[model samples]
Target: MDTEQQRFMNMKRRVYKIVLPVLTVSLGLSLFMSAHKGLLLTINLILLVGMLFAWLFLSTKLPLRVIEWFLLTLAGIYLLTMVVQGVYTQMLGHGETSLGDFIVWMPMISLLMFLLFDRWPALIANLALFTVLVLPAVPAFPRLNPEQNESLILFYSGIVVYTSLAYFLHQLYRTRAEQNAMLRFAYVDALTGIANRHRIDTWLRKKVELGEETGKLFSLIFFDLDNFKDINDIYGHKTGDDVLRQLSKVVGEELDHGDLFGRWGGEEFVVLTDTGEEESFRLAERLRKALEDHDFGIAGRVTASFGLSVNRPGDTAESVVSRADERMYHAKQAGRNRVTGRTMVSGDG
Candidate 1:
């Protein structure tokens, strides 16, 4: 997993750790404070113990994913109990009291939904709770006194409004988080944690466009692992992937600030920097040497070939990349590990 995803999971685990104990204590205090020693009290005691046990188990070797599922199930059961209590109270002609209690707890339930799950599951759970709460009020409307019915109307209205707003806010948060995740996946190479081909293309296009407008200088280095297929064939694909990831890191560390580096395809990579042709070629040679010196463990020593190109006036992304790629193949043809490139001039083919 990526760092961001790991951090998110850790935060969730911490929240669950706090929530379980707090909920158990709250229920325990409520059980003591209540006057009735009937079925409701028994249920509350049972739920309190369950929550306490869940909290204790959280710190054990039990998997956090299992605990998360348990909490969600527990929350559902708690909601069902509230609904049942509301129905029982209404049947006993305590509609006002029941509705008030539901109103007070409705926000808590909504908050729990937001905390426990992502947008869609939370929305579905809240919708089901809202439906249950409102259904009872409908048929029992005429039987209620005018004042009681009016209060019910107001309370139900508040419930709907509160849940609607909650849902909206949660949905907004979910949408943004999803967009961020999509962008990360789009731009990042999963194996190496570097920019992928699409990101490299996008960065180059922007740099090329900016250079065309303002006379800013930029260059690209297209390179590939030397004899990469042989390494994969000898050591298996797993170690070959490791060599790529390690080499990417080592070379990436050597690049200047604001430069972009990424995988271009299998065994091929690219780097972009705002440097002249000479500096770009020097940077490419530095990268080639760095990989040559590094030990790739199971893959043994590795080397790379590089080609450099300087951006010229009116140069498109395709033209600049094609030139560098052509030089790269030339480097491969001349020798296995080397740097070969030339700068282009305005109006030069």
Candidate 2:
């Protein structure tokens, strides 16, 4: 439900990106062309085509090859040509556009290029080339004023456009960065900063098909802090939490990025390792001893017992987890602060 809502909002955003601009331009042009000859109507038609082409090029699932580039290039060329034509219609004699206007419009064109190519330098270079090639022919465009102070107006106009665009881009980048950080916090454990249980579960579910396809087995290791309640009683919950925090940090730092670690519950941590018996047992033992030898200053000392189990053929996630849970209980029965592993080959009994 949340994902569906996100998609709907995203689709609405895209609709606004295209629809709002075209509609505003169309409304203004419609009134102007209603009084003038068919020139405004022609310009409006071209704008519609440009917008429709943009929607198709950006929204399609197909590869962004030369064909996509060709379409975008056409849209840019068309918009530029129409702008020039409007200027030519207004200019009757030796008219010229200000260099200021040239500067201002360059950034706008650059931004448009960014929207098209999704690369900065490439689009900036293209805009520079385009502005240089087109500026000299300003008199040929309709509705251009080649009169006094025109250069100054153009320069200021360009500055305003560029400043506005830069500000917009900066704001967008900052917003996205903040959003990404927030998402990371939500999915990560607060104390350990490792993948939380929710994330680990999601990861396993996503990879189930891949595991089946490869005929590969996966392992889960469950570890518990024995006498954790006693420690909490003697040391206080704060100290107990600190101990767990330190343990999480050490275990998290030692494991490879491919491994997933999560706080299973109070005083319990689990890991989903990609390796088999020997490697998994070695990893579990390594984590077990690291805590046994180390002393947490406030919490004094603690130990962790671990149980490992491999996935059986055609086993569900729950069944595999149950096997690991059973092994973990056995580790508790034998002694605290040790590692145990078992693979189920037969029935539930």
Candidate 3:
């Protein structure tokens, strides 16, 4: 998983960890407060015990999906019970334990619903609770005094407003996070965790434009593994991937902060540096020696060939890269691991 999803899951897990103790404490307090009332005592005791079982189930080794479903069911049933109790209190008044008054806390429950699950489950739970609460004020339902009816309507309004805001905020957060993840994924290589071809293309294009407009020099080096397919054929594809990742890491570390480096394609990497042809050639030679010297563990004794090109007065992105690619192939033809580049003469190919 990426960083964003990991962060989101960590936060959700923290909330889940807090649920059991918080519910236990809240239900215990309610039970203590309503000890003298038989119906309230019974309801609070049942909820407290249910919450206890939920906590125990969560503490077990069961699968996460099962535990999530179990917890969601517990939360849903508890909220429904609260709503039902409110409806009962509207019909037959409870001395001091008015279920209608507890409607204010429904927002907290709804918030938990959205955090624990997705919007659909939360929405269904909210609608069900809303319907139950509104029934007390409905004309077909048993009538209460005008003041009591007004209180229920106001309570229903609060629940609707609070839950709606909570849902909106949750969705907003999710959308923003998803967009960020997508943007990150678009530019980043999945295997190497560096810039991919598209990002390199964009970066080189911008640099090319800037150099052309201002006469500022920039350079590119296109390099590839020498006999890379041999590693895959001998050791297997997994070890080949490991070698690529390791090579990327070493090369990336050797680059300056102002330089842009990325995987151009399979076993081929490119580097764009803010320098002239000589410096670019030196950089490529340094990278070639680094790879030749470094041990790639299972792959062992790897080498690379490099081709270098510097930005010219009339250069485009494609032209600069093609020149570098051609030089790299020339280096490969001469020998496997060397840097080959030259200053561009007028109309030189």
- Specify the highest-lDDT model's number: 3
lDDT score, residue 317, model 3? 96
lDDT of 3 by residue, 147-265 (tens): 55555567667878888998899889889988998999999999898899999999998998999889999999999999999999999999999999999999988998899999999
List CA RMSD, all candidates. Answer: 6.8, 15.7, 6.4
Instruction: Please name the candidate that would achieve the greatest TM-score relative to the true structure.
Output: 3
| Model 1 TM | 0.65
TM-score of 2: 0.54
Cα error, residue 261 of model 2, in Å, equals: 2.2
RMSD of candidate 3 to true structure, Å: 6.4
**Cα lDDT for residue 292, candidate 1:** 83
Task: Give the candidates in order of TM-score, highest first.
Answer: 3, 1, 2
Q: Write the per-residue lDDT of candidate 2 for residues 1-349, one digit (tens) a residue.
A: 4764567446644754565466446545664555533654565565556555555654664444443355446546644654454345333332534321223224544454444444455445455645644574544434444462464355435544664575468558658957987888777887666677777777666555556778676778888988899978998888888888888888877788788888877777888888887788888888887787777886666787788887666767777778778888878887667787874211111
How well does each candidate superpose onto the true structure, as a TM-score? Answer: 0.65, 0.54, 0.68
Worst 10 residues of 2 by lDDT: 96-105
Model 1: residue 82 alpha-carbon error in angstroms:
9.3
Please report, in order, the local distance difference test score of every candidate based on alpha carbons.
0.76, 0.64, 0.77
RMSD of 1: 6.8
Q: Between candidates 2 and 3, which one is better according to TM-score?
A: 3
Candidate 2 positional error at 120, Å: 25
